[model samples]
Target: MRIPSLKLLQGFEAAARHGNFSRAADELCLSQSAISHQVQQLEQQLGQPLFRRVGRGVELTVAGEVLQQSVRRALDNLQGGLGRIAGYMDPGLVVLVCPAALAQGWLQPRLAELRRALPQLSLLLSTDESARFVDEIDVDIVIADRPLQQPDVMERRWLRDGWLMAAAPELAQRLAALPPERQPSEAGLLCLEDGFTDARAGELFRAHLAGFRRVGIYDDARLLLDAALRGEGLACLPKLLAAEALADGRLQAVAGYPAVDGAQYWLARIQGQPRAAIVAEVYAWLARQTEEA
Candidate 1:
């Protein structure tokens, strides 16, 4: 079947939504008779009556109601797509790519501070882990564990986390019952497979935790911390991620384990973007937050 004209469809859609041809005409800036004529044209093309005249107003027939739902949905989708395209072209928009765990544990809580610091900036947070440079993504900045080494990009160490072995209070108590030397052997370890920023740190972590029996392995810090909270095992996590839990008595540090220097978070951006100054401002604000962290 041939597709009906957009004008006819638009007229019918507006009329059906308002339940009055006159109001639809007013909204479309056309006369009521013009709206009636378009609706009649659409109905003739479809070989069905689209509306039933009720006194001065009109009501949609069963077929018209179905068409209205489809038309409204299509129009909404078109408008939404255009809005996203506009946002993509917006110069003030800053996109950030970072890990989901960090986004949830760190960045999300301090969003209000960021807003106050950069009132004119509009931020879009992406949890894509594979993007190496700002050009690789639609992002203005990248907050990642490893530094980007591209010539077109600049990176700086944003945060250096202090790590500690922690577990749920109940799990800590269970470990405490064992002798100092036997505790490491007896306790189950919740390990993060790729937690370190560099190979050297990963090697150090592996060497340090070699004595513990591995019970679980995770890629995400949040999941590792969650497992520890459930009394599943003792996990070595950044103090920044576990601070609130430790303070609330939900998790506690294991005795005899010193805080080790963990991964460094790096903030990267393209060297010569139009928003370079804005990126630097945000980078400085993040550094300030890290100092407080």
Candidate 2:
């Protein structure tokens, strides 16, 4: 009941993937005969033929196909572990992952603050949220809403979406002056569109505004924000995102319109080591933002 050597498994996996011993040998920096020898040793140990000759190349047998699946997964996991080690070894590096829309809407607006907070830190800001939070090995912080059950990962309340109807200063006043009946068709709405039906704001406003004109329907809130800034129309936007503009008098929340509280996003971090100083700074900034909420 002994396991085959790693070299044997690597050889078998590479050969099966390439369907050619010479190609597999080239990839592993070994000769064709050496790769063949390793595969032979593995087959003998497992008491089954792993590959069958097909013309100038080879193909996996039924047992080999099953083993290939496991071997590929094992190698991928090992690679991810090693990559995480590399990230830890680099003292200044902090890998941050967040949703694209959030990055555009939130981080882009706070670039100055981010630079001031970590002048010496190397920040890798990734906006690809398609991958599952736990499977991301090298990432230091994740801004996500998905709940993770793992004990080793720490989660904090990050942001709760608060949707409000808003527009540029001039437009806000105009919308306010309109009678309630005519506001729906005349306000000129700039809508936010996302995978969610509401885009966090649309559904709440929809019931009241039946025939409103769409100035534009944008996938990114940032875009809709820009249109609102240009005095395009009233938009359903995250109040937190518009806070700075609202304070500066660039945008104003339309009064007496229905506003809805939306979903909350969580800040997730790995609890164990390979920690960077920059990671703490980034987490602290997010913590402060939550505190502000």
Candidate 1 lDDT by residue in tens digits, 1-293:
89887788888889998999999999999999999899988888999998998998899899988999999998899889999889876655778888787786667767888888888788888888886467734667888888878778877888776677888998798777876457777678887776544444465456766677878988877888899899888887777677668877999988766556766889888775536466678767876765775
Candidate 2 lDDT over 163-211, as tens digits, reads: 7788898878887898766777666878776513856455565566556
Candidate 2: stretches off by over 4 Å: 1-90, 132-137, 199-203
Among all windows of ten consecutive residues in candidate 1, which has the lowest summed lDDT?
Answer: 195-204
Error of 1 at 5 (Å): 6.9
Each model's C-alpha lDDT?
A: 0.79, 0.79
Task: Say what the RMSD of model 2 is.
Answer: 7.4
Runs in model 1 with CA error above 4 Å?
1-8, 40-66, 79-93, 109-116, 119-122, 130-137, 147-152, 160-163, 169-180, 193-211, 243-251, 255-264, 276-278, 287-293
